[model samples]
Target: MWPEVKIVHGKPTHSQSQGSVERAHRDIEEMLGAWMDENKTKDWPAGIKFIQFKKNRALHSGIGRSPYEAMFGCPARVGQASAGIPHDLMNHLATEEDIENLLKEMEGESNDLEDPNSHGEREDEENTVPETVDAVRTESNEDVVCGQCYTVLPLGEEVNNDGKCFNCERQGNIVNERKRSRESLEKQATKMLKLSKKKFSEVQVGTTVRVPIPDVDRARGSPRNVLAVVGSVEDGLYKLCMCS
Candidate 1:
């Protein structure tokens, strides 16, 4: 189906020949395991689809862009899948617009509360509660308000010692986790590259080299009997042509 593709077979058990494919397989396995554990399901076939969706949208460290964006030449557009869910069950599924409007409303109420000119206005309206105040009062009876954002959390939901709701706490944790993961990955990659540099030198085109024979082919040839000539080099990868 893909006419533009050129297939080159790699030697069996030679991961260096297909490092990208090996890495992708490792990532997919990790994601699939996490998905299955989160959903409490053993059916990995169903989880693979979700894993693929997430992987394509995730940013690739080497490419510096998501695979979906690289292939489509645009960023992937994601929709709110929880839009049809009931608000009580999925209260945390607030959209960007909803959050923005809530922030604006809170800022306006804060200004109203602080203004000395509004003292007479508040006294005049003492019999009638403001909409924001009424909303807070209504939610406080059934939910807990976050100390940081004043967002109402569902009853029985966990809150941090500092009174931050689950959503706020999760967001903070995710940011910190991502920062630590990125730093660790960068350090590991740098160390690996430094070690590889000391072990291997650059190969030039037309240079004859002895490549290791795969285990499956070892019966027919020596371990390092395969001879090849480097044809070209691009992006630190060498294209080699097998010699008879």
Candidate 2:
């Protein structure tokens, strides 16, 4: 069993106590915002993995190294999975340019009657056509769908019990719309925080400021701000003292 860690609570008035955590949250929010824009989907669970990967790899300004490097005491091997492929095997792999070059070579060789061996190679490739066709047909036959309706049919054993396709069990649901709503909510929250930050006026010691009051906890028509003078400013935050 691991040793129990003590949690130190910071004063609600001073957010500077949890500066690192707040900063990290801001960074993650920015990343999530970008991902939402790029993917245009509410699949945040999928995108979180990519965010974590980037965070671990990215260099920390304070640490002078990435989180992965700091923890492992070594630089992370990026794309090592793909890089592990043998150089000889990689060279043998045909890319688009290689395929294009191959077509050009075949065309040139086709005209050159001098190369009788090239024709034999082309004939050998053509011989595999029947096998490919048979494989496609076999796969298509195995993928049996509901004959009455075009929906995917159940497996052999399941089909006997149900006697109908899965979609036949009617249910109305808007899964895609729900996901879009969630995505919109997350984006709106991020945008609101950004806009609020921008609208915030700079405060210094002796400067009076107005802050919003929660409507749920108090009366809806209650005054938004109680006149409060800034006592001190540290780390770009105002320490406000209420004026009598």
Candidate 3:
């Protein structure tokens, strides 16, 4: 009899299948944490872009090159210092007028960086999404409007639980619009997890579990522990059946 060959697919929760992605996530978290500690600030979103830039330019042991260099034929181009224009060539080729123009451009950039109004404008642009949503909500007509873009809900079109119209809900614009910075959310989540921490044995299929009686049931002199057996597990959720 010939041996049978079968291919077994990995489960979605299988860590082995996502080792590299998990490692990358760990590296990002460590770098972001260090950055936050150094800055004495919890604003991770501000530092994440800089971390991403650094990560791309960093040499990778596996790839034998920086990710930026691997993607492009050359190393990542950064500030004016590494602009790749040869100093000798510039001195020989650039006219006095060209040099003056370059100095004027650099001065303009420096002035823009120093300008408080310019910085405020950049911050305003970053924070405008919530303001836009609020403005849209206030200006919307009495007719059913999408929670996201404030577009009128057409007849026969469904609105989600949050009152977002079909198109807006499908595109997840409402969720995206309401999203806080990842670092802020992650910090909040960590605090919540710490506050809610409890010790419990690992649950599995066929494991016996005890559920607490509701307040109303307890008032009626019901037992605190209601015994149940886990029937199945899916996506960290356990299906349980009360013992007869």
Candidate 4:
């Protein structure tokens, strides 16, 4: 009877239930497409996570609130983020600070980094997770974003150290690029298509899936919900279209 949608970060990631909330479901599907294609993460859950985090903190125009803040009354809190993460890495798990530290330590112990027998190339440890940055509503006003801070960065711009701010060249852990990459994908609907894009993927004639929609599926719905066939692809899409 009642409708409910789940929020990842600060945006409506899925319509978990049904209601009259129909406006932009397809858009979310499109987002997932772009993310999976870019990250090449064949794993369904892994890919959705990639896009979910980005949208939570994106700036919103409607009431000027990201879905994250609206859902939980706050912005998205990124636990930890690594730096220079390669796209297709099977064994690449370098941490955020591994950039110079790893390289320095590796070169210090070995003469040739490109050596065949070399054990260390950059960092000695595996990829370390990024530290959590507080993403919340303003201290006094729980609406506007004062700005996010980096955990690793030293205080002030005078330090001339890592985690510098993009706006004022300050210090920070998560860069603007990473943040933007996530936000851009949120506009589309990637999760929807992958999870329930087609027909007959549900339990019965129109079973609801307990999952989140991706970033690129560009249909219409506030949270995004529709009816479809049980496993018959043709029945699902065609019937689902009528429900929408």
Top candidate by lDDT: 1
By TM-score, how accurate is candidate 3? 0.32
lDDT of 2: 0.64
**Per-model CA lDDT versus the true structure:** 0.74, 0.64, 0.69, 0.47
Tens digits of per-residue lDDT for model 3, 1-244: 5469765443334246597798899999999999999999988999989999999999765545566655544567775436444456465534667656676776887798899879877787769867876676678634677877988775346678897776765455433422423334566667656675544445878988888864543644557778999999887677999847
**Residue pairs clashing, model 1:** none
Q: Estimate each model's TM-score.
A: 0.36, 0.33, 0.32, 0.25
lDDT tens per residue, model 1, 1-244: 9999986554657457598889889988999999999999999999887788898889876555666655555556665432333345346646787655655776898899999999999887875657656776587655678988898775457578999987777667656545555666787789889999889999889999888756665664446567899999989999999845
lDDT of 2 by residue, 13-116 (tens): 43556887888999998998799789998888889988988888797655455666555454566642234443444466467665456557757765865677
Q: Which residue pairs in candidate 3 collide?
A: none
Candidate 4: C-alpha RMSD to true structure equals: 20.9
Model 2: per-residue Cα lDDT at residue 134? 74
Q: How many pairs of residues collide in model 4?
A: 67
Location of the lowest summed lDDT over 10 successive residues in candidate 2: 169-178
Q: Could you tell me how far off, in angstroms, the CA of residue 44 lies in candidate 4 after the best superposition?
A: 3.0
**Residue 222 lDDT in model 3?**
55
Best prediction by TM-score: 1
Alpha carbon lDDT at 23, candidate 1: 82
The full ranking of all candidates by lDDT, starting with the best, is 1, 3, 2, 4
